[model samples]
Target: MVEHQRRPGWAEVEDFLSATLVQGGTEMAAVIESIDAAGMPRIEVAPTAGKLLMLLVRIQGARRVLEIGTLAGFSTIWLARGMPDGGHVTTCEYLPEHAAVARRNLDVAGVGSMVDIRVGAALDTLPTLLGGEPYDFVFIDADKSNNVNYLKWALKLTRPGSVIVMDNVIWEGTILDPDADPDAGAIRAALEFMGASPLLDATAIQTAGSKGWDGFAIAVVRQGSATLGE
Candidate 1:
């Protein structure tokens, strides 16, 4: 059953908006279907959220993007579409199966050439990324436990003015409750880290939509960004 089944009315509105406003959303629908058919978890970002990322890309005139999670590449496609003609997106995925599906999906959507998929435990992969000519935009949607670390790396790999967006920050409005979900611990920790950390000027935006009650956190690297208490 589609997640929209839980909130049919709002979901319908989102669907309508996608049909009318989201360019390339038709192909995005097919990408979701393909991901589902491959038996991957149905946890990709909502269509509206995907479009929002693309909007940010356009707003920033971002030429280089880094994505922490590449679930079937749905969001990757959207981010890739938002890039300038020579722009590129580098996304990391832990699961090889999911990476394969994402690759095919990107190809079908005709943006494969613009994306480079790095498959492995992100912890092992993130540290190896270069800091020279830092990325302009980054999206983190991988395991919540490592979000803090990912944010650390994001700060290291990006220069001032770069944008980093983290999904599921609200944990379905349970961010305040320590035991609300398994990820709550990490979510809470990451939020706290961002709050006092000098590296990012961040805020969490709660949202309820076809994907249910959740939200994303967006942070911009300030001048002289650093990790933790550095």
Candidate 2:
């Protein structure tokens, strides 16, 4: 993993943007506190990024969302809030303890009913989601080592025009050198898959903030992409 260096200016600008634009409010604050209280990792997306997820879901007109990670349900809350009434989200968490924490946070956020927290390795859980409705949006943010696996599953679970968002792509610029670390290598492989796949039109953006230098990649499944169980 790259050593995340937090320059003062990056954090300051992030705070300013989050306040002036994100405006996540007290509810969002409570969710953040819950993560701390549960001693969970504070690796949830920034407020601005959360808002971006919301906007992306809304823009996609997505009624079904598949999330490969549920870190205290922080990003899950954003995804849930973006959907129209009766929309649902299925999120996978690898740890039962984490899932419990996330359940509470989602309930407190008033979006619990819309979220299904499945506790298991995402690769194991993703296959179970098959034979269901095609997800309109997919978010992959769990273990970096399985990013390419998650991306493949996203393709199977979604239809053409569906959007997929993968977080922590930049990894403090380790992506440029695939040999930098295990995560760097895996992330680079995933990016290569995205770029070379005929099924996706994708791009990655680098960002710096309180989380330090990192980024996310967004892709839209192209028309006629092969979907499993089609």
Candidate 3:
């Protein structure tokens, strides 16, 4: 068996390809360009991932979605667009500035009403939000150190068969090393948790293209007897 050699900056390359493929689409392309102009941390999920997310939401017929990060609302727009007519996505951002920009982007995308931009630490906000109701899908793409915490919260609030997509799971090849960096350690822990969790059926895919050196882990909450999209 060949060793699983971790690629470098694969996630970034994937994002670039996503932007490239989605280019020329009037509204989505414009949003991608604006995000590029901002020069913010290039942590947003790739457009292909966004499309996959939308498809997952639509496949589950998700009416309520939760996103842990809302950077520029790029990924949020994709999620919102996938919603069945009245579906809504509640996304959280720790930085006020980022949240504000995301709000604006969502507004520009005409998905403001469907996408709620919450400004605060997702850790603090997730508990409170969970009290109200559960979400049909949850996407995690925030501080890598808190990924495990985010997954814990997501597991509690999502119903059976709900999809939970975690970005940057490979962490620029850091995760493959036995001696882990802080962020890599955290990502490893989350991956381990998902691997062992009885309630989740998870898989990680290695993607290569524009966004470089990374991959994502997608876990589906398993519902016994009852099928998804009931």
The lDDT per prediction is 0.87, 0.93, 0.81
lDDT of 1 by residue, 74-187 (tens): 999999999989999999999999999999889988899999999999888877776456899999999998988988888888888899899998876677787867798899
Best by lDDT: 2
Report the C-alpha lDDT of model 2 over 40-82, residue by residue, as the tens digit.
Answer: 8999999999999999999999999999989898899999999
State each model's C-alpha RMSD to the native.
Answer: 4.7, 5.1, 6.1
TM-scores for all predictions: 0.91, 0.94, 0.85
Off by over 4 Å in 3: 1-24, 178-180, 224-230
Rank list by lDDT: 2, 1, 3
For residues 1-230, write the lDDT of model 3, one tens digit per residue: 99997765755665576667654256677666777777777667767877888888888789999999898888898898889888989998999988877887888888898987788899888877755667989989999889878888887788887899998888678887736588888899899989988878999987665566678999988886232221
Q: What is candidate 3's CA lDDT for residue 199?
A: 79
Worst ten in a row by lDDT for model 3? 221-230
Q: C-alpha displacement of 193 in model 3, angstroms?
A: 0.4
